[model samples]
Target: MFGIYIHIPFCRKACHYCDFHFSTSLNYMDEMVDAICKEIALKADRVSGTAGSIYFGGGTPSILPATALQKIFQTLEKHFDIATGAEITLEANPDDLNAAALKTMRALPVNRFSIGVQSFFEEDLRWMNRAHHAGEAIDSIRRSQDAGFENLSIDLIYGYPLLSDEKWESNLATAISLQVPHLSSYSLTVEPRTALAAAIEKRKEPAPTDAQSAEQFRMLMARLQSARFEHYEISNFALPGQYAVHNTNYWRGVPYLGIGPSAHGFDGHTRYMNMASNATYMQALLRGQLAEERELLTDHDRYNEYVMTSLRTMWGLDPELVISRFGRSYHDYLHTALGKLGSNDWLISGDGKIKLTTEGKLYADHIASELFKVDEE
Candidate 1:
């Protein structure tokens, strides 16, 4: 099944840890919406068949008005075949999900809300420069549930300087208490050029420690698993049958259309990346042209991507599928690589698939990099 991802590149506030392409200014909201709709119509023919999921991600999709969202959906309806029960998700901040907002959202086709409630503590929220307070975070989820939007997820962050082990446990406890079906938790990474990184460089704030992050991640896993949540993906936990459909499709290499500035689309063999500049995206789309670059994947590139994404999921990478898709040579290469891993507690083979041990997950990126298929010099 195909999917579609729309990047709404505007935010009410710039979170300190975010380096995503977005503007705090709403000066061109109408124009950007128009451009997005135009981009959808323009790229309609690229992917065939019904869309199983449509995800609105980025700077804060909920920051847009219901009318703007409706207009975009109308354009999508006119151009694409969306399935009867498609999962349409909007990534929202807690501040935007007020009573009036959720009421208006009920009229739209959006069925899921991925609320960005980074923490349920006022100090933590302030540190991250998050748009909402602890109360707003709690209220927004209740309001969304009250408004009949039960399929919800919330984001939580750990490993920052202010987050002690006690506070980290409290964060997880609060999320579990909220009864949200899905949770996407991440460690605070100080990306270069972001405010967090800048502060650390100047010694204004201490950097997040790997030891702290790993400890918190373990706490997260144990707590959530005991709460009956499945650790489906490394950073995602969900109650039974409540996985994020769009992101799942992404991991499975399903073809999807990416609309709006800075969005990326993939169709098995190639990728389309839109220009990140808002003005450039709008200008190009207004002239009926796409401001995007295309990359055709090589076999090595495809294999590496597959290994990286598939290994992150609870469904481990299949060696048989590797043999069938990439031939005996690549399969042999994999066996050799597995030999190199050699009795490490990081990986386990069961049911003809190779999966990571829970502790191994902390070194997932390292392990995946080790397993990568590289080009011969």
Candidate 2:
């Protein structure tokens, strides 16, 4: 089964930390939506049969007018066979999620809601320049739940200069109080050229530190696990049977089509990304072409990707699959590397699966890279 992701590259406000491709100007909104639809049609024939999930991710998917959302959905329906009861998700911000808007969203195929409630404190909200207030976050969540969209996930951010441990705990407490089924939390990072990065450089804002981030992350994991939430992925927690399907598909190497500017897609063998410019993307679609760059994966690239993605989850790498799928050479290499890594007590093995210990998870990317195959051919 395959999945679909449509990136809506428009937002009402620019968050300081965000580096995603988007425009705050609404001048090109109509043309942008039309271009997305045309691109959807242009790429529809390439999708594999049986779409298991559809995700409306963004710069703020909820910023689009209802008619625009419906038009894209209609386009998908005409071109692809979306599976019955597929997990359809929409990424929304709190300010845009009023009662009337939630009512309209329920009428569409969006079964899951991923609200961008980065923090529940007024100070944190202001620090990040998020579009919503603390009260708006809580109210929008309640309104969405009242509207009968129960499959919900909320995002929280920790490890910033202003987010004290007390505030982080309060954030998780708020999420729990709302009974949200899934939670996606991340440590605040300053991406290059973003406002946050510039502010830090100018001594306007304190930079994030590893020690504080690690401590808060540990608190987050412990609190959520005590509340019966599974730390299924490093940055994700979900109650039973409530994992984000589209994201999980990505982890398990399932194929997906990413629509809209700066979106990335993967078939079983190759990966591609659309151009990041709105004007360029729209012009290409208007001219009956896709401004995407493709990269064909070598076996080593695929193996390294598998190692990196799998190690980040609760389920670790499988030696048997490595041997069968990648070759005996990879199988032997995995064992040899495991021996070296085991000395550090970072990884634990049992029940025919290898997984990261609590300490190992902090450096998961480093561990995966250490086990990588760097040879060509």
Candidate 3:
């Protein structure tokens, strides 16, 4: 199944830890939206199959005026063969969520809402430099539910320097208490060049420790599992069949088209990303050219990508698929790597598939790296 992702690269304020391409300025919103709609029209033929999912992700998708979102959705419907029952998700921040805005959203074709409620504590919110307060975070969900939007997901960040173990537990409890259907929890990592990194360097903010992050991750797993949430993915939990279909399709290596500044698209073989700069993107689109760069994937690259993504999911890596796709050498290499990790209880093999155990998940990246095939000089 194919998917479409629209990136809205504008936020009200920059979160200290965010390294994503977004501007706090809304001056270019109109022009950017028009350019994106045009880009969508231009690239519609590129994704001619029925779309299973349409995702509106960004700096803050909810920050856009409802008319802007409506126009884009209309354009998509006009050009693409979107499925009858597709999962259309909008990533929103709590501050932008109110009764009036949610009522407008409910009238649209959007079926899912992924709220960016990173924390439920005021101290943690302040630490993250988020725009919303603790109360707004809780109210946003309640407001959505009040407006008859139930297919909801909330994002949570654990392991922040200010988020104590008790506070982390409280955050999860708040989500569970709200009866949020899906939860996407992430451990805070200070990416290079972000404000968080600079702050840590200057001793303004405490740096995130690996031990704290790992403990919080463990806590996340335990709490969610006890609440009957399915650990469908490494960072995602759902109730029953409520997985984020857009993200799942992406991890499964399905073809998708991404539009807007800094958007990335994959069409099975080649991957392309739009220019990250808003001015450059707008200029090029106005000139009727998509400002993007493309790279063709080599066999080794594809295999390694498969290993990295599949190994992290609950559905593990299928050995037979590997053998059939990448030949005996790669398969044998994987088998050897699996054997090395066997003693550590990092992997469990049965049937034709091999997946990571909970303990193995802690070192998932390291394991994938060990299994990687570097290019020969």
Clash totals for all candidate models: 0, 0, 0
Best candidate according to lDDT: 1
Give every collision pair in model 2. Answer: none
Per-prediction TM-score to the true structure, in the order listed: 0.99, 0.98, 0.98
Which candidate would rank higher by lDDT, 1 or 2? 1
| Candidate 1 collision pairs | none
Worst 10 residues of 3 by lDDT: 337-346
Which lDDT tens digits does candidate 3 get at residues 132-215? 999999999999988888999999998888888998999999899999999999889889999999989999888888999999
- For candidate 1, the TM-score is 0.99
Distance from true position, residue 223, model 2, in Å?
Answer: 0.2
1 or 2, greater by TM-score:
1
Off by over 4 Å in 3: none
lDDT of 2 by residue, 1-377 (tens): 89999999999888999999989988999999999999889888777699999999989999998899999999999889999999999999999989889878877988999999999999889989999999999999999989998999999999999998998898999899999999999999899989999999999988999999999999998999999999889899999889999999899899999899999999978898999999999999999999899999988989999999888888778888888889999989888887776587688887787888888888888999988989664
